[model samples]
Target chain A: EAGVVQSPRYKIIEKKQPVAFWCNPISGHNTLYWYRQNLGQGPELLIRYENEEAVDDSQLPKDRFSAERLKGVDSTLKIQPAELGDSAVYLCASKGNTEAFFGQGTRLTVV
Target chain B: DQQVKQNSPSLSVQEGRISILNCDYTNSMFDYFLWYKKYPAEGPTFLISISSIKDKNEDGRFTVFLNKSAKHLSLHIVPSQPGDSAVYFCAAGKSSGDKLTFGTGTRLAVRP
Candidate 1:
Protein backbone atom coordinates (compact mmCIF):
# COMPACT_ATOMS: atom_id res chain seq x y z
CA GLU A 1 0.00 0.00 0.00
CA ALA A 2 1.14 3.54 -0.66
CA GLY A 3 2.03 5.75 2.28
CA VAL A 4 0.61 9.20 3.02
CA VAL A 5 1.15 11.73 0.25
CA GLN A 6 1.65 15.50 0.36
CA SER A 7 1.88 17.93 -2.49
CA PRO A 8 4.35 20.77 -3.14
CA ARG A 9 7.19 19.38 -1.06
CA TYR A 10 8.58 22.89 -0.83
CA LYS A 11 6.95 26.33 -0.86
CA ILE A 12 8.14 29.90 -0.67
CA ILE A 13 5.79 32.80 -0.11
CA GLU A 14 5.87 36.46 0.75
CA LYS A 15 5.12 37.53 4.27
CA LYS A 16 1.59 38.64 3.45
CA GLN A 17 0.69 36.01 0.91
CA PRO A 18 -1.56 33.03 1.39
CA VAL A 19 -0.43 29.43 1.01
CA ALA A 20 -2.10 26.06 1.06
CA PHE A 21 -0.92 22.47 1.36
CA TRP A 22 -2.65 19.25 0.49
CA CYS A 23 -2.57 15.78 1.97
CA ASN A 24 -3.86 12.37 0.96
CA PRO A 25 -3.86 9.87 3.76
CA ILE A 26 -3.36 6.17 3.54
CA SER A 27 -6.39 4.20 2.45
CA GLY A 28 -8.58 2.91 5.27
CA HIS A 29 -6.91 4.98 7.97
CA ASN A 30 -9.41 6.59 10.29
CA THR A 31 -7.32 9.38 11.75
CA LEU A 32 -5.56 12.29 10.05
CA TYR A 33 -3.43 15.06 11.49
CA TRP A 34 -1.59 18.24 10.59
CA TYR A 35 1.59 19.18 12.41
CA ARG A 36 4.13 21.96 12.47
CA GLN A 37 7.77 21.31 13.26
CA ASN A 38 10.13 24.17 13.88
CA LEU A 39 13.85 23.81 13.83
CA GLY A 40 15.14 21.56 16.63
CA GLN A 41 11.65 20.71 17.82
CA GLY A 42 9.28 17.80 17.54
CA PRO A 43 6.07 18.11 15.59
CA GLU A 44 3.22 20.09 17.14
CA LEU A 45 -0.26 19.03 16.16
CA LEU A 46 -2.20 21.82 14.50
CA ILE A 47 -5.36 19.87 13.80
CA ARG A 48 -6.78 16.36 13.81
CA TYR A 49 -9.65 14.75 11.97
CA GLU A 50 -11.70 11.61 12.42
CA ASN A 51 -13.28 11.11 9.02
CA GLU A 52 -14.86 14.33 7.73
CA GLU A 53 -15.12 15.98 11.12
CA ALA A 54 -12.29 17.74 12.88
CA VAL A 55 -12.00 16.17 16.31
CA ASP A 56 -9.17 18.41 17.57
CA ASP A 57 -8.25 21.88 16.43
CA SER A 58 -7.38 23.62 19.63
CA GLN A 59 -3.82 24.18 18.55
CA LEU A 60 -4.71 25.64 15.21
CA PRO A 61 -4.52 29.41 14.96
CA LYS A 62 -7.99 30.43 13.84
CA ASP A 63 -6.99 33.91 12.78
CA ARG A 64 -4.75 32.80 9.96
CA PHE A 65 -4.91 29.04 9.74
CA SER A 66 -7.73 26.83 8.53
CA ALA A 67 -8.01 23.15 7.60
CA GLU A 68 -10.60 20.96 5.98
CA ARG A 69 -10.87 17.26 5.27
CA LEU A 70 -13.64 17.25 2.75
CA LYS A 71 -15.24 13.83 2.36
CA GLY A 72 -12.54 12.52 4.76
CA VAL A 73 -10.11 11.12 2.21
CA ASP A 74 -8.03 14.21 1.45
CA SER A 75 -7.21 17.28 3.54
CA THR A 76 -6.09 20.83 2.96
CA LEU A 77 -4.42 23.32 5.30
CA LYS A 78 -4.36 26.99 4.40
CA ILE A 79 -2.63 29.94 5.95
CA GLN A 80 -3.74 33.43 4.98
CA PRO A 81 -1.53 36.50 5.08
CA ALA A 82 1.35 34.37 6.25
CA GLU A 83 3.92 35.69 8.59
CA LEU A 84 7.66 35.20 8.91
CA GLY A 85 7.05 33.15 12.01
CA ASP A 86 5.20 30.63 9.86
CA SER A 87 8.34 29.35 8.21
CA ALA A 88 8.51 25.71 9.16
CA VAL A 89 7.79 22.24 7.89
CA TYR A 90 4.11 21.34 7.76
CA LEU A 91 3.55 17.63 8.06
CA CYS A 92 0.51 15.40 7.50
CA ALA A 93 0.13 12.00 9.09
CA SER A 94 -2.45 9.23 9.30
CA LYS A 95 -2.91 6.30 11.62
CA GLY A 96 -5.24 4.37 13.90
CA ASN A 97 -4.56 6.26 17.16
CA THR A 98 -1.34 4.58 18.34
CA GLU A 99 1.05 4.37 15.40
CA ALA A 100 1.22 6.96 12.58
CA PHE A 101 2.63 7.02 9.10
CA PHE A 102 3.85 10.42 7.92
CA GLY A 103 4.35 12.21 4.65
CA GLN A 104 7.65 13.84 3.72
CA GLY A 105 6.10 17.24 4.56
CA THR A 106 5.96 20.65 2.90
CA ARG A 107 8.73 23.01 3.79
CA LEU A 108 7.27 26.52 3.93
CA THR A 109 9.42 29.59 3.85
CA VAL A 110 7.90 33.01 4.35
CA VAL A 111 10.14 35.81 3.32
CA ASP B 1 4.37 25.01 29.52
CA GLN B 2 5.70 21.95 27.75
CA GLN B 3 3.86 18.83 28.84
CA VAL B 4 6.42 16.44 27.40
CA LYS B 5 10.16 16.84 27.93
CA GLN B 6 13.25 15.29 26.43
CA ASN B 7 16.05 16.72 28.53
CA SER B 8 18.93 15.45 26.46
CA PRO B 9 19.27 17.31 23.21
CA SER B 10 21.60 14.75 21.72
CA LEU B 11 23.52 11.52 22.38
CA SER B 12 26.47 9.71 20.88
CA VAL B 13 27.03 5.97 21.06
CA GLN B 14 29.37 3.50 19.49
CA GLU B 15 27.90 1.47 16.66
CA GLY B 16 27.94 -1.74 18.66
CA ARG B 17 26.95 -0.19 21.97
CA ILE B 18 23.54 0.55 23.38
CA SER B 19 21.73 3.87 23.07
CA ILE B 20 19.21 5.05 25.61
CA LEU B 21 16.77 7.95 25.09
CA ASN B 22 14.61 9.30 27.88
CA CYS B 23 11.35 11.22 28.15
CA ASP B 24 9.20 12.66 30.92
CA TYR B 25 5.60 13.78 30.94
CA THR B 26 3.62 15.94 33.31
CA ASN B 27 0.25 14.32 32.62
CA SER B 28 -0.62 11.25 34.62
CA MET B 29 -3.74 10.75 32.54
CA PHE B 30 -1.66 9.71 29.57
CA ASP B 31 -2.49 6.06 29.07
CA TYR B 32 -0.39 5.53 25.96
CA PHE B 33 3.17 6.42 24.95
CA LEU B 34 5.00 6.16 21.64
CA TRP B 35 8.40 6.68 20.07
CA TYR B 36 9.07 8.00 16.60
CA LYS B 37 12.27 8.36 14.59
CA LYS B 38 12.85 11.14 12.08
CA TYR B 39 15.60 11.85 9.61
CA PRO B 40 16.53 15.18 8.11
CA ALA B 41 14.04 16.37 5.48
CA GLU B 42 11.67 13.50 6.21
CA GLY B 43 8.66 13.16 8.45
CA PRO B 44 8.74 10.97 11.54
CA THR B 45 8.07 7.26 11.39
CA PHE B 46 6.57 5.23 14.22
CA LEU B 47 9.17 3.18 16.04
CA ILE B 48 7.24 1.49 18.80
CA SER B 49 4.65 2.05 21.50
CA ILE B 50 3.59 0.81 24.94
CA SER B 51 0.27 0.97 26.76
CA SER B 52 -0.05 2.25 30.32
CA ILE B 53 -0.63 -1.08 31.98
CA LYS B 54 2.53 -2.51 30.47
CA ASP B 55 5.97 -1.57 31.72
CA LYS B 56 7.97 -2.84 28.80
CA ASN B 57 7.63 -3.79 25.18
CA GLU B 58 10.39 -5.17 22.97
CA ASP B 59 10.66 -5.41 19.21
CA GLY B 60 13.81 -6.83 17.76
CA ARG B 61 16.67 -4.70 19.09
CA PHE B 62 14.46 -1.80 20.11
CA THR B 63 12.80 -1.71 23.51
CA VAL B 64 10.47 0.79 25.20
CA PHE B 65 10.09 0.92 28.96
CA LEU B 66 7.55 2.90 30.93
CA ASN B 67 7.57 4.00 34.57
CA LYS B 68 4.06 5.26 35.12
CA SER B 69 4.58 6.26 38.72
CA ALA B 70 7.32 8.62 37.71
CA LYS B 71 5.58 9.69 34.50
CA HIS B 72 8.68 8.69 32.58
CA LEU B 73 9.52 6.41 29.67
CA SER B 74 12.63 5.32 27.80
CA LEU B 75 13.71 3.78 24.52
CA HIS B 76 16.74 1.51 24.21
CA ILE B 77 18.51 0.46 21.07
CA VAL B 78 20.80 -2.50 21.44
CA PRO B 79 23.70 -3.10 19.12
CA SER B 80 23.20 0.31 17.65
CA GLN B 81 24.34 1.06 14.14
CA PRO B 82 25.24 4.10 12.11
CA GLY B 83 22.01 3.83 10.20
CA ASP B 84 20.12 4.27 13.45
CA SER B 85 21.29 7.82 13.86
CA ALA B 86 18.30 10.14 13.84
CA VAL B 87 16.06 12.32 15.98
CA TYR B 88 13.95 10.38 18.48
CA PHE B 89 10.68 11.79 19.76
CA CYS B 90 8.52 10.63 22.65
CA ALA B 91 4.81 11.26 22.64
CA ALA B 92 2.06 10.79 25.19
CA GLY B 93 -1.71 10.69 24.89
CA LYS B 94 -4.76 9.71 26.84
CA SER B 95 -7.25 7.19 25.51
CA SER B 96 -9.90 9.88 25.49
CA GLY B 97 -7.78 12.67 24.02
CA ASP B 98 -7.18 12.34 20.31
CA LYS B 99 -4.20 14.66 20.25
CA LEU B 100 -0.69 13.72 21.30
CA THR B 101 1.84 15.78 23.20
CA PHE B 102 5.34 15.50 21.78
CA GLY B 103 8.69 16.06 23.38
CA THR B 104 11.44 18.29 22.03
CA GLY B 105 13.28 15.22 20.69
CA THR B 106 16.76 13.80 21.25
CA ARG B 107 19.20 13.35 18.43
CA LEU B 108 21.06 10.04 18.53
CA ALA B 109 24.33 9.73 16.72
CA VAL B 110 25.61 6.19 16.39
CA ARG B 111 29.19 6.29 15.21
CA PRO B 112 31.20 3.48 13.66
Candidate 2:
Protein backbone atom coordinates (compact mmCIF):
# COMPACT_ATOMS: atom_id res chain seq x y z
CA GLU A 1 0.00 0.00 0.00
CA ALA A 2 1.12 3.52 -0.67
CA GLY A 3 2.20 5.60 2.28
CA VAL A 4 1.11 9.15 2.98
CA VAL A 5 1.58 11.35 -0.08
CA GLN A 6 2.34 15.08 -0.10
CA SER A 7 2.53 17.47 -3.00
CA PRO A 8 5.31 19.86 -3.97
CA ARG A 9 8.37 18.42 -2.26
CA TYR A 10 9.64 21.98 -1.88
CA LYS A 11 8.15 25.46 -1.94
CA ILE A 12 9.59 28.95 -1.86
CA ILE A 13 7.61 32.09 -1.14
CA GLU A 14 8.30 35.60 0.00
CA LYS A 15 7.39 36.82 3.43
CA LYS A 16 3.79 38.09 3.76
CA GLN A 17 2.73 35.77 0.92
CA PRO A 18 0.25 32.93 1.12
CA VAL A 19 1.21 29.28 0.69
CA ALA A 20 -0.57 25.97 0.90
CA PHE A 21 0.47 22.35 1.36
CA TRP A 22 -1.42 19.21 0.51
CA CYS A 23 -1.48 15.70 1.96
CA ASN A 24 -3.18 12.41 1.05
CA PRO A 25 -3.23 9.86 3.81
CA ILE A 26 -2.93 6.13 3.49
CA SER A 27 -5.98 4.19 2.43
CA GLY A 28 -8.29 3.10 5.24
CA HIS A 29 -6.42 5.30 7.70
CA ASN A 30 -8.79 7.38 9.83
CA THR A 31 -6.25 9.50 11.69
CA LEU A 32 -4.27 12.28 10.02
CA TYR A 33 -1.75 14.71 11.43
CA TRP A 34 0.14 17.77 10.30
CA TYR A 35 3.52 18.60 11.79
CA ARG A 36 6.17 21.24 11.25
CA GLN A 37 9.88 20.60 11.77
CA ASN A 38 12.27 23.46 12.10
CA LEU A 39 16.00 23.13 11.61
CA GLY A 40 17.71 21.04 14.27
CA GLN A 41 14.40 20.29 15.94
CA GLY A 42 11.93 17.47 15.92
CA PRO A 43 8.50 17.61 14.35
CA GLU A 44 5.84 19.52 16.25
CA LEU A 45 2.15 18.84 15.88
CA LEU A 46 0.18 21.57 14.17
CA ILE A 47 -3.17 19.77 13.98
CA ARG A 48 -4.76 16.35 14.01
CA TYR A 49 -7.89 14.90 12.47
CA GLU A 50 -9.95 11.89 13.30
CA ASN A 51 -11.90 11.17 10.17
CA GLU A 52 -13.29 14.48 8.96
CA GLU A 53 -13.26 16.20 12.28
CA ALA A 54 -10.35 18.14 13.66
CA VAL A 55 -9.94 16.58 17.07
CA ASP A 56 -6.84 18.52 18.15
CA ASP A 57 -5.46 21.80 16.90
CA SER A 58 -4.39 23.69 19.96
CA GLN A 59 -0.87 24.15 18.67
CA LEU A 60 -1.98 25.69 15.43
CA PRO A 61 -1.53 29.40 15.07
CA LYS A 62 -5.09 30.53 14.56
CA ASP A 63 -4.17 33.95 13.32
CA ARG A 64 -2.26 32.79 10.26
CA PHE A 65 -2.46 29.02 9.98
CA SER A 66 -5.49 27.01 8.95
CA ALA A 67 -6.03 23.36 8.04
CA GLU A 68 -8.84 21.22 6.69
CA ARG A 69 -9.35 17.51 6.16
CA LEU A 70 -12.15 16.82 3.72
CA LYS A 71 -13.72 13.37 3.31
CA GLY A 72 -11.33 12.16 5.98
CA VAL A 73 -8.77 11.10 3.42
CA ASP A 74 -6.93 14.18 2.20
CA SER A 75 -5.89 17.35 3.99
CA THR A 76 -4.61 20.81 3.22
CA LEU A 77 -2.75 23.28 5.42
CA LYS A 78 -2.60 26.94 4.58
CA ILE A 79 -0.51 29.78 5.90
CA GLN A 80 -1.54 33.32 5.11
CA PRO A 81 1.11 36.00 4.98
CA ALA A 82 3.78 33.57 6.06
CA GLU A 83 6.71 34.99 7.96
CA LEU A 84 10.39 34.19 7.62
CA GLY A 85 10.12 32.10 10.73
CA ASP A 86 7.58 29.92 8.97
CA SER A 87 10.27 28.27 6.88
CA ALA A 88 10.34 24.60 7.77
CA VAL A 89 9.42 21.15 6.65
CA TYR A 90 5.70 20.34 6.73
CA LEU A 91 5.06 16.65 7.34
CA CYS A 92 1.84 14.68 6.98
CA ALA A 93 1.15 11.39 8.63
CA SER A 94 -1.63 8.82 8.98
CA LYS A 95 -2.25 6.23 11.63
CA GLY A 96 -4.02 2.96 11.29
CA ASN A 97 -3.89 0.76 14.37
CA THR A 98 -0.63 1.57 16.10
CA GLU A 99 2.07 3.03 13.92
CA ALA A 100 1.78 6.29 12.08
CA PHE A 101 3.41 6.53 8.64
CA PHE A 102 4.80 9.84 7.42
CA GLY A 103 5.08 11.45 4.02
CA GLN A 104 8.20 12.77 2.30
CA GLY A 105 7.19 16.26 3.52
CA THR A 106 7.07 19.67 1.86
CA ARG A 107 9.95 21.98 2.66
CA LEU A 108 8.85 25.60 2.72
CA THR A 109 11.30 28.43 2.44
CA VAL A 110 10.01 31.87 3.28
CA VAL A 111 12.27 34.57 1.93
CA ASP B 1 8.72 23.69 27.84
CA GLN B 2 10.22 20.78 25.94
CA GLN B 3 8.48 17.64 27.11
CA VAL B 4 10.97 15.32 25.50
CA LYS B 5 14.71 15.93 25.19
CA GLN B 6 17.64 14.18 23.53
CA ASN B 7 20.62 15.75 25.24
CA SER B 8 23.13 14.51 22.72
CA PRO B 9 22.93 16.49 19.54
CA SER B 10 25.17 14.06 17.68
CA LEU B 11 27.05 10.81 18.11
CA SER B 12 29.74 9.01 16.19
CA VAL B 13 30.37 5.27 16.14
CA GLN B 14 32.52 2.96 14.14
CA GLU B 15 30.94 0.44 11.85
CA GLY B 16 30.33 -2.91 13.55
CA ARG B 17 30.11 -1.19 16.94
CA ILE B 18 27.07 -0.41 19.02
CA SER B 19 25.29 2.93 18.95
CA ILE B 20 23.15 4.07 21.84
CA LEU B 21 20.92 7.15 21.65
CA ASN B 22 19.20 8.31 24.80
CA CYS B 23 16.02 10.27 25.43
CA ASP B 24 14.18 11.56 28.48
CA TYR B 25 10.61 12.71 28.78
CA THR B 26 9.05 14.87 31.46
CA ASN B 27 5.44 13.70 30.99
CA SER B 28 4.66 10.90 33.34
CA MET B 29 1.36 10.26 31.62
CA PHE B 30 3.03 9.19 28.43
CA ASP B 31 2.45 5.46 28.09
CA TYR B 32 4.00 4.74 24.74
CA PHE B 33 7.44 5.53 23.38
CA LEU B 34 8.74 5.34 19.83
CA TRP B 35 11.89 5.99 17.84
CA TYR B 36 12.05 7.35 14.31
CA LYS B 37 14.88 7.56 11.80
CA LYS B 38 15.09 10.41 9.33
CA TYR B 39 17.29 11.22 6.36
CA PRO B 40 17.98 14.52 4.76
CA ALA B 41 14.99 15.99 2.90
CA GLU B 42 12.85 13.07 4.01
CA GLY B 43 10.20 12.53 6.63
CA PRO B 44 10.90 10.40 9.68
CA THR B 45 10.42 6.65 9.41
CA PHE B 46 9.28 4.57 12.34
CA LEU B 47 12.17 2.54 13.68
CA ILE B 48 10.89 0.80 16.78
CA SER B 49 8.42 1.27 19.63
CA ILE B 50 7.83 0.04 23.15
CA SER B 51 4.83 0.25 25.41
CA SER B 52 5.05 1.63 28.93
CA ILE B 53 4.19 -1.77 30.29
CA LYS B 54 7.23 -3.30 28.64
CA ASP B 55 10.79 -2.43 29.56
CA LYS B 56 12.47 -3.74 26.45
CA ASN B 57 11.58 -4.51 22.86
CA GLU B 58 14.06 -5.82 20.34
CA ASP B 59 13.81 -6.22 16.61
CA GLY B 60 16.76 -7.50 14.61
CA ARG B 61 19.44 -4.85 14.97
CA PHE B 62 17.35 -2.25 16.75
CA THR B 63 16.28 -2.42 20.38
CA VAL B 64 14.30 0.06 22.49
CA PHE B 65 14.50 0.15 26.26
CA LEU B 66 12.06 2.13 28.35
CA ASN B 67 12.52 3.05 31.98
CA LYS B 68 9.27 4.46 33.27
CA SER B 69 10.71 5.26 36.68
CA ALA B 70 13.29 7.59 35.22
CA LYS B 71 11.09 8.62 32.30
CA HIS B 72 14.00 7.67 30.09
CA LEU B 73 14.24 5.62 26.91
CA SER B 74 17.10 4.54 24.74
CA LEU B 75 17.52 3.04 21.29
CA HIS B 76 20.41 0.68 20.61
CA ILE B 77 21.65 -0.36 17.21
CA VAL B 78 24.04 -3.27 17.12
CA PRO B 79 26.77 -3.70 14.52
CA SER B 80 26.03 -0.29 13.13
CA GLN B 81 26.40 0.23 9.44
CA PRO B 82 26.89 3.27 7.24
CA GLY B 83 23.26 2.94 6.16
CA ASP B 84 22.23 3.50 9.75
CA SER B 85 23.66 7.01 9.82
CA ALA B 86 20.79 9.47 10.24
CA VAL B 87 18.89 11.57 12.72
CA TYR B 88 16.95 9.62 15.31
CA PHE B 89 13.99 11.11 17.17
CA CYS B 90 12.35 9.89 20.33
CA ALA B 91 8.62 10.39 20.79
CA ALA B 92 6.14 9.73 23.54
CA GLY B 93 2.35 9.64 23.73
CA LYS B 94 -0.35 8.83 26.20
CA SER B 95 -1.69 6.18 23.88
CA SER B 96 -0.96 4.57 20.57
CA GLY B 97 -3.29 6.97 18.78
CA ASP B 98 -2.62 10.11 20.75
CA LYS B 99 -0.54 13.03 19.62
CA LEU B 100 3.17 12.31 20.14
CA THR B 101 5.65 14.70 21.67
CA PHE B 102 9.08 14.45 20.07
CA GLY B 103 12.62 15.16 21.17
CA THR B 104 15.00 17.41 19.30
CA GLY B 105 16.67 14.35 17.71
CA THR B 106 20.18 12.88 17.79
CA ARG B 107 22.22 12.65 14.62
CA LEU B 108 24.17 9.40 14.50
CA ALA B 109 27.10 9.01 12.18
CA VAL B 110 28.22 5.43 11.71
CA ARG B 111 31.59 5.72 10.11
CA PRO B 112 32.60 2.85 7.89
Q: What is the TM-score of chain B alone in each candidate?
A: 0.97, 0.99
Which residue runs of candidate 1 sit more than 4 Å off their true CA positions?
A: none
DockQ of 1: 0.72
Model 2 C-alpha RMSD vs. true structure (Å) is 0.6
lDDT of 1: 0.93
Docking class of 2: high
Model 2 interface Cα RMSD in Å:
0.6
- List candidate 2 segments past 4 Å from native: none
The candidate maximizing DockQ is: 2
For residues B61-83, what per-residue lDDT tens digits would candidate 2 score against the true structure?
99999989999999999989999
Q: Number of the top candidate by TM-score?
A: 2
True interface contacts reproduced by each model, as a fraction? 0.80, 0.85
